[model samples]
Target chain A: MNAIIRSTARCLRAGAAAVYLPVRAGARVWSASPPRRLLCAAADLQKDLGAMVKKDKVVVFMKGTPAQPMCGFSNAVVQILRMHGVDQYAAYNVLDDGELREGVKVFSNWPTIPQVYFSGEFVGGCDILLQMHQNGDLVEELKKLGIHSALLNAEKESK
Target chain B: MAETADHIRDKLIEELAAVHVDVEDTSPNRCAASFKVLVVSSQFEGKPLLQRHRMVNTCLAEELKEIHALEQKTLTPEQWEKQKSQ
Candidate 1:
C-alpha cells in the first residue's frame, strides 16, 4: 500500500519535471534580453523556493533524484533516509535545472549542494545528516515529525 | 588558481582561530578539487552545526568557488577533547 503511493508520487514528480524543464528554459531565454528581467527571475525563484521547501515534511535539494543520485554525497543522504524508513520525502534534482542549482545555494545561504530541510528548516548537508544519524539525533528528529524510525524497532529487537 | 590543502589549513587556523585542523585532499589524482577537513575551534563553542558550517563556508568563500567538494567536521575544543579521550 505504501509502495503504491510512493510509486505514484514518483510518477507525478517525473511528469512534473517533464513539463517544468522546457518552461524554465524558455523563461531563461526570455530573461536574457533585459538586465532587470534577470533580477525579476531571481526574485521569482526565491518565492518559488520558499514554497517548495515547505511543501513536504522532508525536502532535499540534491544533485539527483533519490533513486538515482549523481553524486556520492547525495547518495549517502538517500541511504540514510532509507535506513530510517523515510520514503515519502520530496527530492529535487538540482542538476536538471541550472537556476535551481544556483538559486538554492542563495536561498539556503549555504554554499553547498545536497542540502536537506526538515519541516521547511535548513538541516545542513551530508556531513551533518551523517552526524545526526550516528549520534541518535536523527531518530529523535524523525519522531518529532511523527515519523518513527525503523532503527528504533531494530534496536529494541536486538536487545 | 586551485586551492591546496595547506592553504585551506592556514586559512582556517588564521580566520576561525582553529586550534587543530586536519585537511586531506581526497581527490584521486591530488588535483585539490576535493577536500575533507576536521576543524576544532573555540569559536564553535556555543554555535549549532549549521552556524559552525556557515562560519567555515564564509571563511573559505573564495577557496570554495574553485573547489569541487568539501566535507567538514567541526567541533569545539571541549568536544574535541572528549572525542580524543574516547
Candidate 2:
C-alpha cells in the first residue's frame, strides 16, 4: 500500500519540465509532459479563489479535513505546517475533489496532496516542507514573501 | 451484538448480495479507524471507481465515523474475473 501511495505521488522532477506520474502501479513511473501554460483563470477553483487565496496566504488541500486527517501522511504535513507557525493557511479537503487531487498533480505539476501552496505557488509536500524547516530555509522563504512563517500569537508581544 | 468488520461484512453481503468481499482492519493508524476492502459485486458493473467506493462508503456511512481510511479495490464480478487472468 505504501508503494501504491508513492508510485501515485506526483512531484516536480529535478530539472524536468514534465511531472513524473505513476501509472500501472509502482512498476512504472510514466513521464507526463505538463502543458506549459499558467492558466490560473482556467482553474476550476477559480470562481471562489479570489476569496480563497486572499483569505489565506497559505492553503493546503489534502485527502481529509484538517480536524480529522484520514491518513498518516496527511497528518504529517499538517503538523509540519503548524510547526512553521503557519496556522493561518486555509485547508481544502481533497476527498471532496476527484479532479483536484489528481488534477492538482498536473495543476502544480506535482503529485500528492496535503499539498501546500504559498501565495498560490506550489511549495512542495510534507517531506520537502519539513526539510526546509530543518534547514532554516522555509522561514526565510516565507519571510521574503511577506508571509508569516509560523502561527503568530498575540500574547507574545507583551512579553 | 456490537460492531465488527465481520458484522459489517455480513450486513454488506446481505445488502448487496455481493459475490465477493474482503475487509481488513487497519485501526493502528492514529486517526479514527481504517479498513482495507476488495469487493466484487454484479451491482457495481459499469460504475465509476469513486461511485463504487462511495457505495461501500455509504453502505457503512454510519459505521464510517469509526473508520477513517477505506482503501478500496472494488470491482464488478466481470472485472474480478478479468483480474484473475493476471
Candidate 3:
C-alpha cells in the first residue's frame, strides 16, 4: 500500500510491487516471433540455386535432370552440351521445387527455363546456346573455361 | 491482373527508348503466358547478346514476374536497320 512510500519519502516510499510488476512485465514480454514462413520457403530455394550454380563450372537449371529432360528446350541444351563434350556439369531440376522453378527466373533475371551458367555466371538459355553453337562461339567459350570438345575438331574435319 | 502484349511493348519502348519493338504473345491459347520480343535500341550498341537481353529483361522486370515465358532478340539500331534492308 502507501506504507513504503510514506516510510521512505518523508511522505511516501516505493509503491506496491503489483503496480510496477504488471506494467514492466507486460512491456518486457517481447515475443520475438519467428520470420514469416513464406519468406523462408523462397529464401531456401534461392540459397539452393546459388549453391548449385557454384558447384560446377557449368550449371544448367532446367526442367529436368540430364538423364530425363522433361522439356524439349531443356533436352536441346543437354544434347548440345553433351555434343560439345561437357560430360560432368551439374543440372538442377527446377520442377522438383516449386520455389526453384520461379526463383530461378528471378535469380537470373531472365524469364525462361533451361537457364545455363558458366563459372557461376548466368549464361543464356537454349536459344543463346544454340546460336553460339552454330556460330562456333560455344566451343571457344567452353575452351576459355577449361572445357574441351573433340567435336569442334571433328566438325572442322567434316567441313 | 495479367498484362497484354501491347502493354508490355509500350513499357519496354518507354523505358529503353527503343527505336523499334515488337512483342508477340506466343502462348498456344494466347493467354499472355509466353512472349517473343524483338527490340532495337541504340542503347544496345556494343553490348553482348547476353547483356542486350539482360537490358530488356531489366526493363520488363515487372511484366516478367507475371509472364511465364519470354524470348528476346535485342539489336542496336544499326543492326536492326541492316536486318530490315537484308
Largest TM-score belongs to which candidate?
Answer: 1
Taken over the whole model, the C-alpha lDDT of each candidate is 0.83, 0.60, 0.75
lDDT of 3 by residue, A1-159 (tens): 696554344212112210110001112232322112222334554665666666567878887777788888899998998888786676667777555577788788788798989998898998789878877899888998998876867878999
Instruction: Give lDDT tens digits, candidate 1, residues A1-159.
Output: 997886566455544542222111011232221111123335766777777777667888888777788999999999999999888777778998776788899999988889999998999999999999999999999998899999998989999
Ranking by lDDT: 1, 3, 2
How well does each candidate superpose onto the true structure, as a TM-score? 0.84, 0.41, 0.74
Question: Positional deviation of A57 in candidate 2, in angstroms?
Answer: 1.2
Would you give me the overall lDDT of model 2?
0.60
TM-score of 3: 0.74
lDDT per residue (tens digit) for residues B52-79 in model 2: 6557766876675555455567678888
How many backbone clashes are present in model 2?
Answer: 6
Residue B70, candidate 3: Cα error in Å is 0.2
Report chain A TM-scores, every model: 0.76, 0.59, 0.70
Ranking by DockQ: 1, 3, 2
User: What clash pairs does model 2 have?
Assistant: A10-A111, A84-A150, A85-A150, A85-A151, A86-A150, A86-A151
Task: Estimate, for each residue in B6-56, the C-alpha lDDT of model 3 and write its tens digit.
Answer: 998898899998988999998889999888899989999888888888888
Top of the candidates by lDDT: 1
Give per-residue CA lDDT, model 2, range A80-122, as digits (tens).
Answer: 7667655555666767645455556556544345567777666
The parts of candidate 1 lying over 4 Å away from their true place are A1-40
